[model samples]
Target chain A: MVNPLEIKVERNKHKKTKPPQDQLGFGVHFTDHMFVMDYAQEKGWYHPRIVPYQPIVLDPAAKVFHYGQTIFEGLKAYRTGDGRTLLFRPQKNIERMNRSNERLSVPQLDEALFLSALQQLIAADQDWIPSGAGTSLYIRPFVIATQPALGVSPSEHYQFIIIMSPVGAYYPEGINPVKIFVEAEYVRAVIGGVGEAKTAGNYAAGLKAQEAAKELGYSQVLWLDGVHRTYIEEVGSMNVFFKINGTVLTPALNGSILDGITRSSMIQLLKHLDIPIEERMISIEELYEAGRNGTLEEAFGTGTAAVISPIGELSWKGEKLVIQDGQTGELSKKLYDTLTGIQKGSLADPFGWMVEVSETPSGVL
Target chain B: MVNPLEIKVERNKHKKTKPPQDQLGFGVHFTDHMFVMDYAQEKGWYHPRIVPYQPIVLDPAAKVFHYGQTIFEGLKAYRTGDGRTLLFRPQKNIERMNRSNERLSVPQLDEALFLSALQQLIAADQDWIPSGAGTSLYIRPFVIATQPALGVSPSEHYQFIIIMSPVGAYYPEGINPVKIFVEAEYVRAVIGGVGEAKTAGNYAAGLKAQEAAKELGYSQVLWLDGVHRTYIEEVGSMNVFFKINGTVLTPALNGSILDGITRSSMIQLLKHLDIPIEERMISIEELYEAGRNGTLEEAFGTGTAAVISPIGELSWKGEKLVIQDGQTGELSKKLYDTLTGIQKGSLADPFGWMVEVSETPSGVL
Candidate 1:
């Protein structure tokens, strides 16, 4: 176990002016400080510190640059109405990060140490947490293999760093529906691959497909299973859900689909609200059939970046399937409101999902 | 086109002692200087230069660190018996690097600039090339997205770099056959993914499977196709070949397998020698059946790192299929010698595959 007291703090001598909250776009503006820890095969993880946000110096032959042995987690620090900072189920992200580490053959980070680092860093930079409607400080915790050798095996050194960015609301005005293209020519992941892990390579593999979808004027790509090429896997980088005949359906955790924290939370929320939900293999053909038969009521993508992204249209193989008349469905809006309300502390917490952060740096309890 | 004369050269002032030829390992010790070029959306690729080999400075939020937006190519510089330096099939690698860039949504590099960079870099560090038996300078050319943003998209900035390392013979004593494990639980790549590209993520995805194989007392993992989980894709990171009943068979250029330069050379060599060669799908079942019937004469893997690595034994689902009586097949030895001979400028350049590097730096062609 790492002692919280051992975490050194190096305050920034010169801090940049903070950008206006309204002008902050996604991942554009960063905070003053970042949390960093190093890992060596012989020394374990050491030198946890909160230092000025700066450029990282790495050998050109670092394994992360050549082999992509990296993993990351995304969550947010929300400013509640009561002037308190809250995080939505951060423990889940930490747990999933470890699972990613296991899959990527990177070293495991101590859960307590992870949480402590997050808390201390958040407390130090809490002023960057935006209070605007639907706005929050996005926390990105990533681990990269830092071994300066050009080997194809697990790296002998690593760096776990946490950087925070003040992101504007995904939807500036309101939760608008997005247009998605069903990708048939490119695949994101397959069964028994690294899709379930929040690793860098999975995202790298999807860039071409995403670019193609963009050129076709779609906001994202809805990926199918690489094997059958029919079963739904993900919408862009998010988990997909469809309300067909009043029953919510999502692709099960079948080894390839990411176990999205937001997706899991939405499922729990749906069950609490007494809405029927099912996790199974939902093929694109079945989804299109539901659209044609007028049984597909609503569709949405769930992720940390966008609490709930309503899907208004899905274009697949030259056919456009418009749901809810290309509008945000009632259930989609309701889920979005409920989830964001809980995250921002406007509504009563039913499942105790929100974890509050101390305003003062307590040096990681 | 990048002007060769525009490339600025800055030599290293204090060079470190070069490692002994006998002590050289694969990609362990780098030369004193490296080639670098920067790319920006607005400026394009510029600032081509040679500088002292040092650590690269990048923002913590660089896309390569978070999304694995990177690609690399591997080739070797061989010091001939008469002191001339040669590069085997470098144009193939340069063409393949651009193909990888296209697949990964990265900016395409000029093929002329790539070759010039390799030639100049190798020329500048010509003294580092080892001349001992089976020693060569391994050249690693790579591009990494350097945009410091967390958005999961193609980066607007990139850095292309070339580094060289002196490497000893893959098998210092002689060509040795290795034991391979046919992986079923994990997949290296799938059709419509980044597998065919020589990108970082594909290698990262294979690390876990390779580690598992190493733990099971195997030197490498023979990957099966992601969709079928039976059709052969690759052995470790190399293209696989099987010789059965006097005919050489390799997997077709499926989107899930890398098109290795050595594999291509071997095919051409087989044709030159009037040996039968076929490129098509061959499943593990068929291979094991051939082993059972004593028709699986030989097996080997081809890549730039080892040139040709013979496989003596394969373990699949608790069955050990020994090939060529656990010894290096005659064809494997002949192919290795022929290829290495051509690379080192010791044998006749029948196909003109070897490109000689100028002793003096010729900035660019």
Candidate 2:
């Protein structure tokens, strides 16, 4: 039998009213529609649907519930200054998801098919996109193993889904700087591990350290090399960037750090701007000493969610090295402003990052 | 309002008969009934029941599908020669489950209630237990995050489940030693990581290496320390033990090595037998040198499923080291025989290790 995806439309019948502006936070309120597709070995991907966001019933013995064969990507759909909804390099998320699937040993889907499905779901839920400053519909596209088994190997069946939640400004007040603890005792990823993949285990492994850091009054935990535990890595969920003596410096994408899409874009943007940006292994001691000598200008983390989150203090083992008085640095703000400007359609899209995908590409609108 | 476990049972009207004694392999067949319970924030741990063993239905966005918020335990029940079932130290599994619950931030179930639930299910489907030599029904009790969301944190709700599968001897064809590849380039767990917990992420992280080793004609991978990458940590899914210079040594229970229930029981048995034993960090180079100089006589891995598994050779970095010429060593056989005898009710109950919970405890035929 020739099988294909049966694209179904199940609109929400009992959608709740939008939450008040003040109560809206990150990932708390989801949109009415969510995109979903299922995969089996013989049938491949089938039953692509945009259905009402509802409770998903699953077997208690599903493999993803037992073995963590799951991966996810985070991006956002922007409401342009002229009120047009656009996507920012959504193909990057698709590519990352495929890479992550390869690492997790899940099935790979056509990137174009995934993008089209995402467009359909977002269009159906466009009104849910917040339009204010630094606000957008945070899109989460993910894949998981749905087979019911207790084995350690890959699952035979899978599910790919796209869920959207309207998010407010990352920082409620304004763009703010926070301190991150340089975790020496705990390591996030190691060589030959799933450090580069956007898989679930990586985040789950970092939860305890994140909780401990929050208890210590820090916002995030900056991971170091698993071996030796000295070299700098990413900060919690985002890639780290540093500005030393008018040059953009970040840790090179080693086997143990995530090759973040935002980090790559920022590097490309810096290169285009004719900045001397170096991707090399920068140690914690070197950064701290540079900060002491008044040479470390700024440090920030780059990701699709927060864009560019400024780091003001590096709290090492009992040593507090303030990069810049617990405040957002000038370079951090400039990068954030340029990035958000392009995303929000206030500035020119020099890099061709934004793609208008609402109606039928360019013709239907 | 009074609370009762709300179960929607879907019975399996047809089930294949249990295979003959010779064909039964580990984790290959299941019983008729399985135990399940669900937990939510407002309704904590509801819906406990014994349902037919079948594939589970799941939500596409369940938190375990994306965050690896899952943990599990391995246990077994044996049918004694006089026709009574016995479970060896199930309390240990319960305690470990509680510890795992704390680490993953999942809720804990009362030990008494949990045991009663499992016993009820087992009693309901007790015919699946096999009475042949080294054959028993393996019990897998696990907890998973059943919440549906897209962000990373502790899951608000979870599910606790128990599934059983009948299995024959791990080494039914006589205990022959197996070769393993020593993995220095990869690290399974690091300091302050979730190595002590029997979490899915740990097993998931080891899959690629295990697959590579199996493809290279080895049975499993010998994991090393995440830091330094030289110290021996564990065998995949088992605890490593080395018989060096007539003294038994296993890797110390650092935060990165799981505290295997069988490993502990074997050590206690060895101590009772007046054999020398120590739990400390053992380096790979040291083991190689000892093997070369004839100081290392035997090596083995211990776990719940395979009570004791002997290792005969190790392939590392293009060097194939012949450990014991693929022969099951004397210590390995001795330890295995003792443990199996105790578990199967063939040996005397020394140190009060085995808690025989048959159909009627302390009753005669």
Candidate 3:
């Protein structure tokens, strides 16, 4: 194993002008530098460095282009009011990324090395972290197969990379509930497939269903389990939760549903708040029944991008079910405020979910 | 739609020495030139051309690396003793690729334009087609999302490319039967997923199971349907067929299984030979029962890479059932000889499966 502290750095000569804070959209503008490491079957991972952010060159026959052996993780770095940079639950994202690597048959990355790369890369480009009220630096860590072979077997070469983009809040106009269409035609993933992994193909599989929903004026598609086609799986790319009667219910960690970091955090936060929550299989029919009986108090999706995307309406089988009269629920508001407040360092991090970046210069090891 | 004949060509300045015919392996060495086209949401497909085989430059945030919005097709061009290049069922492959594009939410290519690109690319690099026995040029046509964005949606930009590699026989020592392991713990695909499409994620999802089967001294894994673990779906990357009581049985066109061209051709060839063939679901238990009853005659897989890969032994649930005494059956050998004969132009093409590339210079439009 390579030493995590022995990292090399190559500063970008020409720095890019940062975009205006008000115009910072999600994943549009990127920082000036990135972290990269190469993996070979015989040499393992080597040449870990932070270099200029630029286009990557790859052979057209790279296994990633054909076999899709790739995985990714998403997190954010918040710029505190005291000029400190903080990352929330980064270890959870790193652990989940390794699990995704195992599922995709890619080599496992050393957790220390992975964490060091993120810390150094963020430290090198700390000024790119937007200090706006609802803005931060969105971090994307990904791995791709780079072997220039067309075989179906696992690749012998890989590249791990981390890129950061400054972004505004998901809901720039304040958090409003979204209309979701319950998908019945296309499936995202099955229990035996790669749904649980943060892999590329799972997202690709949902594009068609999401597009169809979008054409019908729905913001997202609520995916159902591939086998039964009735059990709830996910909402677009997020883990879904619902408030039924007085208890919160989210789908259990079945092999097909993603173990979302935000979903876990929400569960912990609800428990800490003395609210009842259940993790079990939930069918769409049962959810609709709760809606008919006025027991479906609120519904929302949890992920890194949106954090807590409240669901205002759900359309399934030509029927529309509006939750909380097509408005955000009180509980969703409370959870969103508390979560964002902790993330931005405006409130106490009672769960100790934040990790502050070291201020030491990260240019040399 | 772009005109099929308006393709430009840029020849390579320095040509590398070709590998010896005996050392040629599958998809390891590429030809001198490759076909390329760009697709945009507003302008459609444009700038179709053939250029020197080289690495592709892509932004670090290209969607293909993150969302897996990609599709591909595999076919081969055989060089006849008369010095003519023959492509087997190219139209079918192009059609299937479009279906995959639809499933992955990618823009569809014009069939005529796709065929023209293939024909031109082959014509430009016709010298790369090996004329030795059991040697041909493997053609890989693929499309990848190229939009430099990190969102979980279909990409607005795409790149279509075709690369060629000269390859020798899949089994250099003649047609030897392979041992297959029946995978019980992992599933390949379920209906309502992207299984029917030739996308990257489906292949990535199977790598873990395939690697495990490899460690067990098996050549490939016999995949079961994701929903029902008992019904057989596919073997490795190919469609499987079994002969029992003098009748050939293969799985029907389930949505989770690929519609293989070689499988279709084999079905047609069997009917032409006055042999009975049935397309229906066959369970592993049923196949094992036939093995015990002395009715299992031959088993084989069909695909572009290995036209006919005969199965000698099957291991499942800690039980091994040897077929035809772990040797290639008589029918398997006959089918391989006939199909290869037709492909290489040594025999009559009864079904008109070969499409001969026109003898025209493809350097300029």
Candidate 4:
């Protein structure tokens, strides 16, 4: 009784026109094929399959619609300098996604099954992987509660899906710095909440503040802790880092900050380069003091979407503070180049982070 | 052109079976007809109609599934003594729902249109309204983002739907007391978050703490303030109140505490009865002190689901503080009776809160 994924190719009666790579935005366009699986309490996960990209039909009372019981992960498949495709640390995303599943009470997937689904789906839609520089096929693996009940409890049924979208470089302006608003009025995540989990509710809670900040001419909102509203937590949807006095510092994962994959990779890369790095609580007051003393050399945000988003300005409580003369810091550029280089298969695989689609066992593809 | 709600009756080609009245649970049973409307940036809200209840079709990348950008409202339709259908101050729920819509970045609904939809839908399914004591048709109106793009932004398209279910009494064992665990470690919401709005994320964040409390033999978890973790915010999903030595008090409507309709009605009723009531911050330390001094006479929670849920025991940290010897307090019982009586049309309507479904204009029906 080995439950394996059954692949079904979409019969294209009409050939779909692919969008121009230069015109493509983040997640507006999707590939033709998608991976889907179901979970029930009695039979567990079953009926894994790849099907045509189409509308998902659900009962109106499904738990995902009413209770926000869903989790998701995002990574990318980069078309290498050669004809092959590469995935950076795909296994790490799967591991973190499982942790997110544990927190949201959604059922976890077998690691092999999860990896096989992604590899095969990417293999089937391999042509959709864009070859433009800094362009890649973004992979979204998410699980949603499918039970058609209107209760607040965890759902007994779930659906795991993997969808692909070809995306352009995150910074259309090319490794530019973004303006941030220090949100003293809104808190993103607090200790002992669903902050660590990559769930939808945490993102929903930040939308209001994000909208307001965008109106205020800021690209993102820098969130503070929920308790004191002083300690720095994150920047927009990404975990943040600060370079003060030759030290690379990020907020410690105090159960509220998300353990971002890109954040970890950047830290590893910085350590490998023999740069000082620390993960600890950094308050706004301390950061401002360092800025005043000219010790705040650089600040940036790290996430899958924007690998390294340098912070140029921070407006905190009507006080504007400029960082590094509003320029992308030297370290920020170096780290971004190194990581994206590794992702595009143009650099040596010292860390063995790149996983190729063809590397999976033959039976899956 | 006037945008009137078009009515479509289900043919019942196959007759539907109704669940037994005695076995009807909270949201398991649904009425035959449901109200639905669509919204777009250019067209506003259009295509208002009542259609047969069925599954909702959406793209897998819908914003509601990924970002939790959805809001909902809950109110009940009651069948009165003389076979009249009544809705208790439903306009208040609509107004609150609109506010929730605003906070969650959803489009605001037209008040008249919202009320008309409810009245017509309830009228169409009037026979489904349960006549059993303490039973009524639960109305749920929700808006979800229908856009297929996978970005964390306010959706361009939306769907608003109203579904009803005939539900039994919240407590089958009569209006008894429930044991509450004072959750010092977990926080449901913080100031400047979406706690006040009746959104899905706040409930999702509470499921874990609620599950832990239920496992520990507690019926609900009482959340503290997200900032200090000292002030009492809410009990489970309901707004909380405490009666200490004859003074009735509830947490002030800070941005985080939901402005519950039942809570407001209870406060009004208390004022009418000449019992002093105050909406201000009340600390747990003060509450425990009152318990130790025998001054904490009564406690209860208020919401649409449970009109008035009395609290009998509170387990905070290691100590168990039993209120009124683990029995329902006098005020709790009186308030429940008065509220339920008004809802059922068994009492004189002094404040003119109950709105009759048959009283609406003919064009709406």
Please identify model 4 stretches exceeding 4 Å from their true place.
A1-15, A359-361, B1-15, B172-174, B359-361
Name every residue pair that clashes in candidate 1.
Answer: none
Predicted complex 3: CAPRI docking category: high
Interface CA root-mean-square deviation for model 2:
2.4
- DockQ for candidate 4, C-alpha atoms: 0.75
What lDDT tens digits, residue by residue, belong to model 4 across residues A106-207?
778888878888888888788899999778999999998999877678889999999889998665665789999999987878887889999998888888
List candidate 2 segments past 4 Å from native: A1-22, A42-49, A171-174, A360-365, B1-25, B37-59, B169-174, B358-365
Query: Candidate 1 has what TM-score?
Result: 0.99
Model 3 chain A scores worst on lDDT over the 10 consecutive residues at: A356-365
Q: What clash count does candidate 4 reach? A: 0
Model 3: residues >4 Å from true position, as ranges? A171-174, A361-365, B171-174, B361-365
Encode model 1's per-residue lDDT on A191-299: one tens digit a residue.
Answer: 8899999999999888888888889888889999999999999976689999999899999999899999999999999999999999999999999999999999999
lDDT of 3 by residue, B19-110 (tens): 99988988889999999999999999999989999998999999999999999999999999898889999999999999999999999999
Q: Candidate 2, residues A213-308: lDDT per residue as tens digits?
A: 889988889998887678898987789999898988999988789989889999998888897899999898999889889989889999877788
- Tell me the TM-score of each prediction against the true structure: 0.99, 0.90, 0.98, 0.96
Decide which is better by DockQ, 1 or 4: 1
Could you give candidate 4's per-residue lDDT for residues B1-365 as a string of tens digits?
A: 22454544343244357788888788878888888889898888888888888889998889888999999999999999899999999999999999999998898998887888889888878888998877889999999988887767788999999998998866544578989999988788888888898888888888888888989988789999988889999986689999998999999999888899999999999998999999999999999999999999999999888788899999999799999898999999999999999999999878889999984445554
The candidate, 3 or 4, that scores higher on DockQ is: 3
Instruction: State in Å the error of residue A155, model 4.
Output: 0.9
Real A-B contacts recovered, model 4: 0.70
**Fnat (0 to 1) per candidate:** 0.86, 0.51, 0.85, 0.70
Give the higher-TM-score candidate: 1 or 2.
Answer: 1
What ranking emerges by lDDT with the best candidate at the front? 3, 1, 4, 2
